[model samples]
Target: MSNLRVAIIGCGSIAQNRHLLEYEENKYVDIVAVCDIVEERAMVTAEAFGAKSYTDYEELFSKEEVDAVSVCLPNYLHAPVSIAALEAGAHVLCEKPMATSREEADQMIETAERNGKKLMIAHNQRFVASHEKARKLIAAGELGKIYSFRTTFGHGGPEGWSADGENSWFFKKDQAFIGAMGDLGVHKADLLRHVLGEEFVDVAGFIENNAKSEITVDDNAVCILRSESGIVGTLTASWAYNAGEDNSTVIYGEKGMLRLEDDPSYSLIAQYTSGETVKYELGQIQSNDEGGQTNTGVIDHFVEAIVEDKKPLIDGEEGKRSLEVILAALESGETRKITQLAK
Candidate 1:
């Protein structure tokens, strides 16, 4: 099979560390072009991938005969770029918090469907090895009747993660739309949905800008969420974890409880009601404090989905549903009331 020609739209940290490197390693892919508002970044990334460079995405779209494109731009640019690429007859792998609003997300999805193109949101946590294992166990009815859960994804701030550090678009409300809620919270929201195989019905959130004086968006947020089937949980997303990043989850079920990424040695630990304990040394979750991240298998899956003519694991609708949960959380926090999601 001929390799799919791919273009990367943002030459930032996510594109550099995740999308670009992964695509280069995938034998089924051939980098065709790279774009960024910063000419130097775009040129450097283009050189690394042996592809053409452009400062404007529209120019790249008009010029390159690409089979697929990765939209790694800021949150606000996600919908426009992805929709444009879909219109240009290429599949789009959009970075998550799919868009700033449900309206934007809905339009992107509609454009892809109208164009007969694929639209996959890059929710890499769903592809984690330990998460995959946990999902299978839950599906097999091992973690019987999940009663509650608490998940957290926190770090020092985007200053360490973004290419521009504290000055990145992530700190601007206009560009980022939401701060930790969009960056870290949405990830857990999506992961929980995938793991529990249920939809979030309502949420109550508390948000504040406890750190990072330069930004207009909140740096810390905590939320209580309930699933459609009555599973309750708390989600915390913060950029104030100045000590080190903590990416962990604990799920309590009638059978017992499961802890993920809570221990240094193991990635998953399960305790059954009958006193049977299983420790899975699958691997460790990547340490953002140490600038380490494991491959999330996003590129491979996106390519394979197109090549096999099948829908991606996280399609547009699935992404929209996950995004809705985050949006509702924001509304709940702003209104100071329990928010309900329409069935």
Candidate 2:
């Protein structure tokens, strides 16, 4: 098949690191156009990848013969941009947190359904080799009768990555909609759901601004989740962990436990009830690491799904699940009670 002509909206860090970089490596993809509110960022990214640049996504969508688009905008813009791209007949790979709210996520999914185009979320943890192995083991019941799990995603605040760091729209309620939960927590939430093959049905949470003195949005969040299949777990996301810990998840069950650590290497540690402990080092969790580039794994998967006419590993509905859990957590935190995922 010929290269899938692709346009990228929001030529931000994620677009630069994941989508653009991944497309550069995929012989089956050609970066066609790039759009960002800042035209210079778009132009620079486009020039780097031999593509066109646009300040307006609508203009890009109209003039480019694009087969797909990756939406890497802030959380609030995810659904609107994705819906527009899908309606324009482009398969969309949207960065997570899928949207600011569940209702918006539903609309994006519906648009993809109506257009019959692929809509995937850039939930790269699902593609991490260690996470994948753990998922397979869990599915195979190697972690027999899964009982509980704990997951965390924390880092020093987004000062260097985002344009304005602490002063950026990321900390603004109008622009970002939420903070740590939307930025990093969603990844862990999605990872948990994917690994266990379960949907969180209820959540109770505590969200706070314990650090980063200037931001109104949360910097720390802790949540308890109960899945539809009766699994229970805890998730903690923070931007205040000094020296910071990369994302990690520990799953425990009747027969054994699986530990996924994303740093130093994508290592999987298994401790069986039979007193046998095994370590499997998956090396790296991502596709490439050109200047802090994230796993191109998700982007490559999106390209393959479009080219091969196969469903992406994390489709529209699947993407929405994590956002649903986050929304539940947010509501639970506000109401000071457990909340259920919207039906």
Candidate 3:
């Protein structure tokens, strides 16, 4: 088969760090065009990749007959841009939170389905080595009868990691929709669901913006999630971890417990009830810090799904399920009530 012609719709940090780099490395992909509202950013990225540059996504789509596109735009544009790409006869790998609302998520999914294009959400936590190992252990009953878990994704903030630094869209409520929850919390929601292989059925949360001044979005959020099998856990997302990042998860089970991305030396540690402790030295989880570049496995999977005509693991429906958890948490925070998810 000919190389898949790909376009990146945003010249943001995510596109530069993950989508553009990984796509360039993929033997089956040819980045045909790059687009951003900032013409200079698009030009630089396109020049680096030997692709065309466009200030407008619609113009890029109209001109370049791309086989796929990576939607790295702001939260508000994920649905519309991905839907447009799908309608234009291209598969889409959209960054999470897939959409601002469930309605928009549904629309994106519908558009993809109607156009027969793959719609994959880039929830990279699911692709982590330790996470994959943990999921397999749980599935094989190594962690028998999973009882509870706590997954957290926290860092100083997105300002340093964003293209615009302090003026990044990540700090704006209008552009980001939800702050820490959308940026980090949704990742845990998707990760938990992926590892547990169950949907979150209930959520009660507390969201606050006390850390960052002049921001209309939450900087810290904690959500209590109950999975479909009645397994309960806490998901915390914060932009106030000034000391360092804390991207870790601990799962408790009847057999024992599993520690993931918690230890500095080992990525996963399994402690059994019989006092047997086993450690797995899987690679570190990707972070926003310097020298944190790692193959996320998201782009490769998306490309493979398209090449093989198979649905991606984190498809539109899966992404929507994860987004619903964040939305429920938002509702819970506002109403001070435990929100029940629709099964």
The RMSD of every model to the true structure, in order and in angstroms, is 1.0, 2.0, 0.8
In order, candidate lDDTs are 0.91, 0.85, 0.94
Tens digits of per-residue lDDT for model 2, 151-240:
998877677566555577778778888899988899989999888988888899999988887887998999999998889989999888
lDDT of 3 by residue, 264-290 (tens): 999999999999999999988898896
Off by over 4 Å in 2: 262-266, 286-290
| TM-score of decoy 1 | 0.98
| Structure candidate 3, residue pairs in collision | none
Q: What TM-score do all the candidates reach, one by one?
A: 0.98, 0.95, 0.99
Supply candidate 3's per-residue lDDT for 145.
100
TM-score of structure candidate 3: 0.99
lDDT of 3: 0.94
Ranking by lDDT: 3, 1, 2
lDDT of 3 at 309: 98
Ranking by TM-score: 3, 1, 2
Is 1 or 3 the stronger prediction by TM-score?
Answer: 3
